[model samples]
Target: MPTWLTPEGKALSCLEKIKVLNENLTEIRELCQEALEDAVLMGCDEPQVRQVLQELLDSLETPFENK
Candidate 1:
């Protein structure tokens, strides 16, 4: 079996990865919210700010896949 399929590895793999991803995404969301609030306070247009953030989010996707 592959290393990741071993008993200890399985025990420590998928859930751990998902938990870490969730934590990172949560932190990014909080930071983005704070930045967007600051941008609005400084008179940046809300829609434009959201568009830029959306593009940034899109860039993180894998190429050629419909995910």
Candidate 2:
């Protein structure tokens, strides 16, 4: 996506930026989930687990849908 679009300094509309960001965010979310589950297996605290996971829920929300 970084390759497909202009550099962060280059021209892009707000909508396009949001689209790319959302795609990148989705990838980040999957990676976070995998890592968080590993932490659980390693016996992280329940509150710690929930606290760490809150970011993913935040990422899943957006006022606009790229689709």
The candidate scoring highest on TM-score is 1
lDDT of 1 by residue, 1-67 (tens): 2223433445446767667777887899999999899999999999999999999998886657432
Instruction: Give the top-scoring candidate (lDDT).
Output: 1
Per-residue lDDT over 1-67 for candidate 2, one digit per residue giving the tens place of the 0 to 100 score = 4434454555566786678787998897788878778888999886787776786577776687554
- How far is 64's C-alpha from truth in model 1 (Å)? 14
Compared with the true structure, the alpha-carbon lDDT of candidate 2 equals: 0.73
> What is residue 30's positional error in candidate 2, in angstroms?
1.1
Q: Positional deviation of 46 in candidate 2, in angstroms?
A: 3.1
Cα-based lDDT at residue 29, candidate 2: 77
What is the TM-score (0 to 1) of candidate 2?
0.46
